[model samples]
Target chain A: MNQFIQELTKGLWKELPPFRLLLGLCPVLAVTKSASNGIGMGMAVLFVLTLSNMLISLVRNIIPSKVRIACFITISATLVVAVELLMQAYAYPLYLQLGIFVPLIVVNCIILGRAEAFAAKNPVHLAIADGLGMGLGFTMSLTFLGSIREILGAGTWFGYPVMWDGFQPFTIMVEAPGAFLCLGLTLAAMNYGTRRQLMKRNREGSEASASPCGGCRACSIGKSQD
Target chain B: MSVFEVFISAIFVNNIVLAQNLGNCPYLGCSKEKGVALGMGTSVIFVTVMATLCTWLVQKYILIPTGLEYLQTLVFILIIASLVQFVEMFLKKAIPPLYASLGIFLPLITTNCCVLGVTLLVQREQYDLMDALIYAFATGAGFLLALLLMAGVRERLETCRVPKAMAGTPIALIMAGIMSLSFMAFKGMV
Candidate 1:
């Protein structure tokens, strides 16, 4: 249970897919024109990631090591097709909105990375937890970035107008260039926050233990002590 | 659209990397060095055109006739994966220097969305065989153009002072954004 929670929470912030791990960037940049679009893409990814992780974990023992990647791609590709069909049936509009990205999910790297790194080695339950965590983390990041772009770019939040009538929308915010700029600034801000927190931790650790490592999180030396 | 128009629009207006946002992993990953970018771009051109042709034939003969169109995602990806492996082996045996230049990047193309994306796009657009090939070649060239431009810029960026936090991917993304903005100038040209 403890390990499951650790796996789950790590994806939320510590290893958030787009911001931290920097995986699956194509969807992150392309589909984030609006908050709803982001959530939609995220949900599709969540569905594929969770089920693929579970299936891969269940069959981990049977798959040959040399052929594991091909196996993983096959599994995820099947799931992506299912996702495409399901979306077409229930959410036809969003299915069209997402377009080719739905199929492109098979190559998202986050799904393949998790399958190779976690699901292949871990048990089913833990793999499920990791997938759920990473999926939710990816969803949260996409929604957050999407909301920022939508609000600034179109003066709306999730299809509803939020800004005053006088507001002049920065149309570029929801365009191709805006996606890159917004993500770049967001990553920088996150890094700055992390650096500040690490510095504070280092100061406290120095006063308490006179440690030689200075409690820097970037290195593994201080991690074991913590 | 005319084949000539398709070629022009693909290379400029709807560039795979800057405009369409496909194959970003390699666009960023391989663009740090000019030579690697050149190698990656060339390999992508070769693989994408071949993959598109294969997928198009399979779609026309196999999936559509068998009514297994819903399985398009699964089948196309499998074909791409196997095709990439075959290409790698063929290159290693027939053209050692070309294989050496491509190196590991050849295998990585199996997963690059641009190849698959182009294949799927041509199908979605319902292009005939001739148009499909031209479109694929043009999209690949667009991707190559974007990658080379980015590599040139990033090479210069290496000598510049960047803040610690935004030193790597963040700054690279910003540069890409600027390049993308410039590419937008070609929007009306098509």
Candidate 2:
């Protein structure tokens, strides 16, 4: 239970997909224009990630190492297609909004990265925990970013008017350029905060502040504690 | 639109990176150095054209005829994956210099959304063989242009001391935001 909890929490902050590892930026940037869209896309990713991770973990031993990448891509792509069909049938509005990005989820480096790195090595149950953690982390971040952009850029929150009419929205916040700027600022702030925490911990006899790693080294991901 | 207009529009007005957000991974990943950026750009162009052409043919003949348009995503990704692999091998054997320069980026192209995005867009827009070819070139060219610009800025940034808080991806992204804003000027040119 403790190990499962650890696997689940690791991807939340220690290895947040976009702000931390910087994988899967295309879908993050493209579909995160509104909170609803972000949630919709996030759920889609969660479905695909958790399922693919579980499936890959189950068959990890069977897949030949030589063609594992090809195998991973195929499995994920098929899952994405199924997700797309389900979305189209059930949630047509979101299905329309997401469009190509839904299909493009197959290529999201986060899924394949985990498949190769974590799932292929771990047992199925642990892989499920990791998948949920990463997927939910991705969801939270995307929704947060999307809501910020939507509120500032469109003067609304999830389509409801949040600001007074006199408030002139920074329309650029919703555009392509805005996506980059918003994400950049968030990353910078996160890195700065983590560095301060690291410094304080070092002062408290942690003695691990000799080198300030960006927390991006894949080998050391989810190692939040010394 | 004329081919020239299409080319210009693709390059500036509807940029693959900024406007369409098609290829942010490699745009940021490969933009650290100008030379590598160019190499990746050329490889993307080659693969985009090749992938677009092959997928376009398949969509028209195989998927559309059989009423399997829903399988476009699955099939296009497979085509793109194999296409990138084949192109990588071909470049390695035939054009070693280019291959050496490309390095890991060549294989990375397999999952690049831009390659698949181009094929999907071409199919969506229903471009003919010739127009699709031009579009493949234009989309790749546009991506290259954005990448080059970003690389030039990043190179200059390395010389100057950046603020501690905004170094790396943050500053790169802010720079991209400014560039995207500038590209917005070309909005109505087409």
Candidate 3:
């Protein structure tokens, strides 16, 4: 149980696919012109990831090593197809909006990366949790990016108007250039926060050591405690 | 559109790399050296042409006829993955120098969106066989052009003192944004 929580939580932040790990940016940038588009793409990825992870985890032991990658690709591709069909049937608008990105999701490194790295070695239940948690994390991150871009670029969220009258939106923010700007700024923000935490930890460690009677004495004490 | 027009338009008007913004992972990640970029471009051109032809055949003969368009994505990916493998082996056997140049990137081609994007775009536009082939080749040329230009710029960027915050991918991304903006000038050409 604890292990499941740990695996799932890691992908949300510590090993996030886009923001942290920077695994899959092609789709992240391409389909995030609108908030609804982001949500639509994210949900599709979540479904594909969770199912692929579970199935890959279950069959990890049975699959031969030489053929594992091909197997994983096949499984992931199958799930992507299933999701693509379901979306086309039920959400034709989003299906059209997402366009080729839906099919391209099959090649997304995050899903394949998770399957090969974590899911293949873990139990089915743990894989399931990790998949869902990571998927939701990816979805939320994209949706947040989309909301910012959509509202600023078009003065709207999704397709509806959100800004006050007389506001002139930045056209580039909603286009291909806008995608780069949003993603770059978001990455910088994440990097800045991470750097701050690292600096803070170092400061606290140094302060703790310096406050002691002696450096050697403190080091010895810490070692003994450990 | 005529075959020449399709070819010309793909190469300039609707370039996969510049206009469509597909396969950006390699564009940003690998476009540091001109030699590498050229090698990567050659590989992309080869794989994209083959993948498009393969998908075109599959779509025309199998998926559309069988009413299995939903499986198009799955089938395309499988074909691409295998085709990449075959190309890798063929390169190693026939041209070791080219193989060395394209070494690791050949495998990465599977995930490079430009290959898949070309396949998808060809299908979406419903191009005839000649049109599909021309578009695929021209799109590959466009991608190569963008990558080479990006690499040339990056080679010089290494010496210039960029802002500390925007030193790496951030600055590269900003440059890409500018490039994308410039590419917008060619939008009405079609």
Candidate 4:
């Protein structure tokens, strides 16, 4: 239970796909102009990631080492096709809006990265948890970033008008340029926050020690290791 | 669309990397150095042309005839992955210098969405084999053009004193965004 929680929550912040680890960046910048589209893409990814992870984990032992990557891609591609068919059938408009990205999900490095990095080595349960966690993390980031872009660009939150009548929307936010700038700025802010937290922790630890314990090389090396 | 228009449009207006948001992973990762960027770009051009041509033939003859269009994703991706592998080995055997330059980026191209995207687009747009091949070549050339431009910018960016947080992917993406905005001007310039 505890390990499962660890596997899940790790993806939420510590290993957030887009912002932290910089995985699956295409959809992050391309399809995230609107919150609805972001959420929709996220859901599609969530479905694919969870199932692929589970299936890959189950067959990890039998797969040949040389051909495993190809095998993993084949599995995910099949699932992506299924997702594409389902979306086309039920959510025709959204599916059309998504365009080639639906098929492109088969090549999303995040999914393949997880299958190789986590699922292949772990038990099925942990792999599924990791998948759910990473998927949720990716989806949450997409939705949040999308909402911000949507609100600022279109003056709407999930297509509802949120700004004052006279307020001018930052039209760039909803375009390709806006997606890049927003993600860049957001990543910078997160990095700054993490650095500040790490610095605070170091300072607190240093304050508790009165004696000078390290010289130039050792102190620099210690911080570098941290 | 005429072949000339397709070539020009893909090169400038519908750039796979800058506009379509395809091949971004390798676009960002391999655009650091000019030589590497060129090598990656050339390999992409080769793979794009070959993959689209092969997939088009497969879709038209095998999948469509057999009523297996639903398996396009699985089939195309498998074909692409293997195509990349075959290209890698053939390149290594035939051109050692080129192989050395491409190095790891060769394998990375296997997962590049631009190649698959072009192949799928060829099918979706219903381009005949010759047109599909030309379109793929155009898209590949467009990718090369964007990558070279980006590599030049990044090379220049390295000298400037950037902020701690925005030094890497953040700034590269912003630069690409500006480039994308600029590329919009070339739209409909047949």
Output the number of the DockQ-best candidate. Answer: 2
> Going through the candidates in order, what fraction of the true interface contacts does each contain?
0.60, 0.67, 0.47, 0.61
DockQ of each: 0.46, 0.55, 0.33, 0.46
Model 4 C-alpha lDDT per residue in residues A1-226, reported as the tens digit of each score: 9999999999998888877677778888889889999999999999999999999999999999999999999899989999999999999999998898999999888899899889999999999999999999999999999999999999999889999989999988887778878887887677666656656667887553322221112112111110
TM-score computed on alpha carbons, candidate 1: 0.95
Model 3, stretches more than 4 Å misplaced? Answer: A200-226
Q: Rank the candidates by lDDT, best first.
A: 1, 2, 4, 3
**What stretches of model 1 exceed 4 Å from their correct place?**
A204-226
Clashes of each: 0, 0, 0, 0
Off by over 4 Å in 2: A203-210, A213-226
* Top-scoring candidate (lDDT): 1
Q: Which residue pairs show backbone clashes in model 2?
A: none
**lDDT digits (tens) for residues B39-107 of candidate 1:** 888999999999999999999999999999999989999999999999999999999998889867877
lDDT of 2 by residue, A1-226 (tens): 8999999999898878777888888888888899999999999999999999999999999998998988999999999999989998899999989887888898898889889889999999999999999999999999999999999999999999999879999999998988988888888888778778778888899768455755533223222100
Candidate 3 residue A210 Cα shift, in angstroms, is 18
Q: What is the TM-score of chain A in candidate 4?
A: 0.90
- In candidate 2 the C-alpha lDDT for residue B177 amounts to 89
What is the TM-score of candidate 2? 0.95
Per-residue lDDT value at B20 in model 2: 82
Candidate 3 per-residue lDDT, tens place, A135-168, comes to: 9889988899899999999999878998999999
